[model samples]
Target: MKKYGLQLRAPSQQKKAAARPPLPPPRGFQEDEDDDVEREISRQASKNKALKDVEEQHKKALEEDPSVFDYDGVYDEMKEKVVRPRVQDREERKPKYIQNLMKKAEQRKWEQEIVYERKLVKERSKDDHLYADKDKFVTSAYKKKLAEQAKWMEEERLRQLREEKDDVSVAFSAISCDGFFPLREEERLRQLREEKQPSVEQPKGDHHKRGGDAVAAARERFLARKRAKLSLVL
Candidate 1:
């Protein structure tokens, strides 16, 4: 009876029963399991999309290749195409100042060579004719040299005259001061021609009638008279 009393009693005639926990739904465990399954499916779909995106990104990365951008090719190509070629063509290009310096140095060297040759010739000359009257020997040699020099000098003079027929120095320098008339023969001829030619003088104006050919006629007469006088003087 005490155990029975502990259980709640419902009045048979009452339409409403005491509020008991609602009866457990049918297939309650399966409904709970379905919720977990739907959540897992959504999670899996998201993971699959992420994986596909990653795979596509990986494929694109692999396909990307620059023909000669890698380290090994980069170094060799740079050396062959850019670095080594430039080095090979980098000649000993002296700037203008350095070139001028080198030219001066070469000129000095040539002068030194000339001086050395002169010294050698002098030493040889001295050794060959020791204790011999040096001036007499040198004079004889000088005379021989002068004859040889004169031969070439005459040839050069003729050559220059041929090249420069109108050279004032060659013609004028060869002449000595003299009567100088033959040189002025052409000028003399010109003067004679000018003297022989007739000249007319203009007489003072208003000597004749105001209108007529009288002025011209008088001028002709005066010229004729002057010419006759000059002829008488000559």
Candidate 2:
């Protein structure tokens, strides 16, 4: 019979499988027992063929290159290079290093516990309402608010003063000698009476009283001058 490289079954094995009764539901709950059996046989055959191929390739490689696996005491050399030093280090230094690490860990844990206990005690002893009274703490924000309020008040006062001064200037413009300088006092009186009139309203404030009084005095003086002029004319 001709040999096949990777046959799933030989001709005699195929004849025997055909002659045997149908496998009894594949020993498990498979719906298609024939297909499941064929697939399982194919998988096993492939696995065996793959293992055989690997073996043949390994033998061919060894035949072609005999020096491929020439260890030549390399195992001993690797052991000396890697394993011996690690073993010696473990014997000589690992124990002491482990002891020092454990000591330092214990010391660190004790220090942390002490610090935590001290913090807990301090918190327990301290007053709960230490920062309750907001007014007791004069922060920069509070100071800034006071400064803004004072500045606003000062600006308001200055504004009122400016208004009062403006009113006084309007009421007594004839008294101020900016450009009008009459040669005779009588002409001056006439000019004051004719050209100047109280048109500006008085500002209402405690500081504006002086300006109001000045305006009233100027008006009274103008009236007096007019009366005297009238008498002289009579």
Candidate 3:
């Protein structure tokens, strides 16, 4: 069993190796995966380079000035940023004529208010008692008129009293001229007839039947009564 010249071989293993097919050429998906890996490696190399540069700059700054870092000293980016002004559209602006009309209207309204205030002040400045003297004069005139009326009434009353006194005196004089007893109205008429006809003689027969003598005596009596009334009036 020492056949060293030929290598020991399994006939099944050799047939399986020959029967296995070669792998297909690299696929589209595999190529895409390879490109992605290459891009990631390049991105990592760029990131490492940036970190190294920052470290070198930091080391150089430390060599120059060895002061402790102050985070508070750093300027805030938001504060340094400039605020943009608001932009206005041309359509938002009013026309010149319309703006001028509005301004004129406001000015007119202001002037009207000023004029109204001045008028109110002038009206307030007027005298409140302008007709005071005239009212006093009218009151005095009315009082004078009342006094004149009262004086005239008092004089009229006095005149009436004097007239009444004169009438009483006349009545007393008439009574005394005849006798102590006041004559009856018929007796007075008879006495007045006798006094007026003293020249006529007494009629012999009935006085009424003596027409001429009776007529003369009656006429004399009428004349005497008329004269008595006239004297009393005077």
Candidate 4:
């Protein structure tokens, strides 16, 4: 059984053993060292070529435009001729009706503003006139004159009031109380005293009672008078 097993080994193990080939011999140190040197040399050559290409480009640019070497001058020159966006002709682009309407609106606005300014000036002038005194001048003498005039006017008013009061008092004294005898000076003084005296305080209910009593008394007196007249007629 062992011999048969050996002969019938796995096909994968046989394939693996057959697939691998023998490796080549190790490289020499000198050859490896030569390869490193060649690689370094090639890298340096590439770097130098790149630098030379940049230098040549710079030289060509300077020859083409000497100002290219002067960066500030080149920048300034470009800036001076900067490309701006073209402005559209809105007047030409707009419809005729819209343009006419806009022009009319602008004219109307200007007219309205003018009218408003004129109105403001008129109003300000009116206000200044209203607040300012036409006859008064801005001086101490003028102020003193105005004060004296006001004082004279006030004194005249007081004198007129006193005269009117005296005339009223004289008229009151001449008034006859009973159609026969005019009020004497003493009687007038007494009446004035009575008028000045404080009235007696009465309760609200008493006021109504007093008023009713006075009305009844007056009615009785009127009846008496009517009876007396009737008797005289008979």
Candidate whose TM-score is highest: 1
Q: Which structure is stronger by TM-score: 1 or 2?
A: 1
The residue-by-residue lDDT of candidate 3 on 198-218, one tens digit each, is 676765356334444544555
Cα deviation at 162, candidate 1, in Å, is 28
Q: What are the per-residue Cα lDDT tens digits for candidate 2 across 157-204?
A: 575567656656766563333333345788678767865786565544
| TM-score, one value per model | 0.23, 0.20, 0.22, 0.23
Query: Candidate 2 — which residues are off by over 4 angstroms?
Result: 1-135, 174-183, 186-234
- Distance from true position, residue 106, model 1, in Å? 8.6
Among all windows of 10 consecutive residues in model 1, the one with the lowest summed lDDT is 172-181
lDDT of 1 by residue, 121-199 (tens): 7778877767566554457876775575457546544754553443333333333222222647887788688868886
In candidate 1, stretches whose alpha carbon ends up further than 4 angstroms from where it belongs are: 1-48, 60-113, 127-234
Please list the C-alpha lDDT of all candidates, in the order they appear: 0.59, 0.64, 0.60, 0.62
Better of 2 and 3 by lDDT: 2
- Candidate 2's TM-score reads 0.20
Error of 2 at 64 (Å): 99
